[model samples]
Target: MKDYMGYSIEGRTTAISTILNQYSSGITLMKQDSNGEFYPLKAKTTILPNGSKSYILTPCNQ
Candidate 1:
């Protein structure tokens, strides 16, 4: 596992429902598509500094 901004990265795949249940509050969930675009999954979200509720998904090609 790795650490990212105080959050632990398990580096494993899991169901989306499991993630939503774990972070049931104050969190915005997004999923990536085959076209490299991201869409919101959950309604509960946090407003970013730019006043946007969602962000662009940047994929790591490593």
Candidate 2:
């Protein structure tokens, strides 16, 4: 699956379409802190299954 920044998560990937099926709204923007913890930037964020935290991306205007 790919995020807004065009980063791809390969190998046994869960389709973003499938996720959207469950959450027709949108994907959550997450960030990892220096201590290695994931947190959402918005309150209305989607909680991904499997609790995977590998796909977090830095927010960008482009």
Candidate 3:
């Protein structure tokens, strides 16, 4: 993973797909809340017709 000033940077050249697929168990997706706190990010992936995948990250309840 690459970081720019304490933030994870995702770019076109980054191989995120492989990382998300192969090492997803180690990754805990997160989201920020209105109170300025972070929580786990729930998501689901769907396969497209072109053999590509799309992720739908569900909103945090709190």
lDDT of each: 0.41, 0.43, 0.50
For model 3, state the Cα shift of residue 50 in Å. 3.3
Worst 10 residues of 3 by lDDT: 4-13
Estimated TM-score for each candidate:
0.27, 0.28, 0.38
Ranking by lDDT: 3, 2, 1
lDDT of 1 at 4: 19
- Which prediction has more favorable TM-score, 2 or 3? 3
Number of clashing pairs per prediction, in order: 0, 0, 0
Report the backbone clash tally of model 3.
0
Q: Which number leads on lDDT?
A: 3
Clashing residue pairs for model 1: none
lDDT of 1 by residue, 6-35 (tens): 232322222332344456765555667899
Preferred candidate (TM-score higher): 1 or 3: 3
Residues 1-62 of candidate 3: C-alpha lDDT, one tens digit per residue: 33411233333113343345456667655656889988765544678899976554444463
Tell me the RMSD of model 1 versus the true structure. 13.8
